[model samples]
Every structure is written in C-alpha cells, then in structure tokens.
Target: MIIQAVAHRGYPKKYAENTLSSFLKAVELGFSHLELDVHLSKDGIPVVIHDHTLDRMTNGTGRVVDYTASELQSFRVKQDEHIPTLEEVLRALKGKIQLNIELKQMGDYYPELEKRVLEVIEAFDMLDQVVITSFDFDALERIRQLSRDVRIGLITFGGSKAILDWSLEMGATFLSMHYAFVTEHYIQRCQDLGIQLMAWTINESSVMKQFQEYPSVWICTDELEGFMDVLEMSGSI
Candidate 1:
C-alpha cells in the first residue's frame, strides 16, 4: 500500500508555516502534495499564512485584511522569512508539486476572496494542479460558481452524514477531516461514496501505521519526514 502524504503547511516542524522557504524545502524533500492557507490582503491580493491575524505567525499585529499584500510581506514570520503571496508560491512550486490551498475566513469574510484566489491560480495555469479547500461552505460555493473545472475540498473537524451530504451537494472532489475523526468504517464509507478522503495534521507513527492500511486515503502531516519514515518501515510506501 502507498500512503499519500501531504506536507501540511510545508513542514512546520522544521520551518515557519506557510513561508516560501518552508514550501520550497518540502519540495526539496520530495513531497508530492503541499497544503497551505490563504487570506486576501487589504488590497485584495491572496497571501499565504494560516491565521486571519498575523500575531501568531509573524512579527506583525492586527488583521491580515488590514494590510496590503506588499505591506504584509514587510512583516517577518520567523527570523527573516517574509509572508508570501499566493502568486509567488504558485510561481515557485507550480510544476513541482500539487497544492491544497485553503481559503481562510473568520467572522466577516473577505470580499472577492474566492474570485481573487481563482484568478491567481488561473494566472499560473495551475487549476489542474491545485485543489481549493475551506471550512467555509459559502466560500466553496462561491468557488463553484466561479469555475466548474476547479477542484474543491470541504474541510471539517469530523465526519458525519451531514458533512458527506454537504460535500456531495457542493460537488467537492475531496473531504478533509481531522485525523482523530477518521476510522476504517469512515474510510470505507468515503471509498464507497466515491469521495476522496484526507486526514490532516497526523504526526504519530502509530496513527500513520493505522492509516496506511487504507491506501486510497490521503494523510496530511506537519512532520512529513517522520511520517514517511514510518510508512517506509511498515513497507507501505
């Protein structure tokens, strides 16, 4: 069995999450897929970073939407790593790896976020190489409205019939769930329903061993190298 592993936020265990260097390093380590978060800057450019606020991941403060993309890039994530624009990330990793771009919003959503993100993806001619994911169903719906060909994934904390129905209704190509919520039965259910399932942020070897049994399922992890080693030891890769 081959475990399909996605480098979650570009190997956050070793580098700053959502930074360009982090993504490039994941590519250097030979990960087939990379997951990242995107929020529209004040100027409406899609920039990569997890939080709607910058306090957690960068030296800056306040809402990400408050700063222009260029202004946001001025803030340092770690020692010197600047926040990257979606275009910059796509330009660098376009042909090298598949990207799982999460459209992020909390409270009030950013205006034209979905449209701007699609424009960026289209600008790079990477619609086939990328999947847009979000916990915000409305945003995913907006993506669906904009382009039928673009792949969409519904991200949720757990699995349930309601979630499945929602994914099906949205015509989502993938269902991304928290690892703790995934089970063999759920895996089989997704397989039976023709929905591709992905488990996220998995780091434990024991968990990796368990998920390896279902080769059709994808796993996203912060510790990509460690998880890969686990799969290698179990002869699942």
Candidate 2:
C-alpha cells in the first residue's frame, strides 16, 4: 500500500503556518495530505491557525478570539503573509490536496464551530477530501450526528486500548497520534478496527525509516521536502 505524506502546518519552515502560501507550497512540493488547525474568529468565521494566542505567529497580541476575521487579516506573519480563513485555505487547496482540519476548542468560543466548518467544507464541495480531527472526542461525536458520511479522526498522544475503543466508538476512520506511541501492537489494533493510523511530527530520518516498516497510512511532518526525498530514495513512495 502507498503511504500518504501529510505536510504538518503546511511546510512551516519555508512559509507561515496556516497561510495560503504555506498550503500552496505543500501542493507544489507534491504533498497530497495537508494538516491544519481551525479556530472561530470573534465574528464567527473559522480561521486557519494553530495557536490560541496571536503573539507567537503574527504581529497581533492577545487571544485570536478577540479579533474578527477582517481584523485578524491585518496581522502579518513573517512580514508579508497574513492570517488566512478556513474558507480561503479550502478554496486554494480544495482540489489539489486532502485536508486534515483540527478544531481548536476555546471555552465559550465558536459554540457552533463544527457546524460552521462543515458548512465551509460543503460550500467548497470538499467533504470527500477532508478529515476533521480533534482531541475533543465530544466534538467528534457531535459532528458524527450532523453528517454520517464526514470522515473524522481521533487525535491522541498515546497508544492504548482505551484510545482505540474511543476512536472506534466515534466511528473515526483515522487514529492520529504522537509518533512515539506507534508500535507493532498499536498498528495491529487499529488495523483490526479498520482504522488507518497516522503518525505525527516524524522529522528524523532514522525515525522515518523505522515508521516506514509499520502500517501507517499517513505520516505528518514539518520537513516535507526532506521526507519526500528520503521516501523516494528508499522506494517507499
């Protein structure tokens, strides 16, 4: 089977995370799987970003929830790139790549985040090309009730029977976890449930080589170009 390579935060080393340019560069580099995070703006628009606070990635300060979508756009990332909305990212990469959108949970924020995100996905006609994932299992369960066909993944930090059970109960198609948690038994358990495994942040060539022997369907990483080169050299792609 052909393992998928997901660009974590869309080639962040070269471009700003969650920006249109970053996603475009991932596509240009031949990455079909793109992983991103989503948070609702104060105005109820779903914006693509990873952090709850804007201080680290953007020119703005304070919580990202404080700004409207338009206001958030004013903040520059790495000088030129501005924060992008989920719709902008969906529009830019809809046909070119598969998206794994992580729904960020902020207390009393984006009460309808799952619904809004599904609306955007439906609007872009990308329901088949996206997998909604989160550490919030409740959100995933709610999403399942809204749309039975939407693909969802359970994001976890460890490999355990409890995690597997939860994922299976939620009808998750993928189990996304930290790379260190992936083991032979973990792979088998996921496989038994017909769930594809996705290992995250595997940047080391040695670790990548080790994971290549496993049955993970996708490997998410920051070093997309480097990992791709390694895979090609090893004839694993």
The residue pairs found clashing in candidate 2 are none
Question: What is candidate 2's local distance difference test score?
Answer: 0.86
lDDT of 1 by residue, 78-175 (tens): 97899999999999997989999999965348989999999999988999999999988889999999999999989999899888887778788799
What TM value does model 2 have? Answer: 0.95
Report every candidate's CA lDDT.
Answer: 0.89, 0.86
lDDT of 2 by residue, 1-237 (tens): 233789999989888888899888888888868999999889989998899989999889999888999999999988899889998888788788888999996444568989989999999888899999998877888789899889998888987888878777777888898988777888887888899889988898888888778745578899987887788889866
TM values, all candidates: 0.95, 0.95
Candidate 1, TM-score vs. the true structure? 0.95
Model 2 regions lying over 4 Å from their true place: 1-3, 106-108
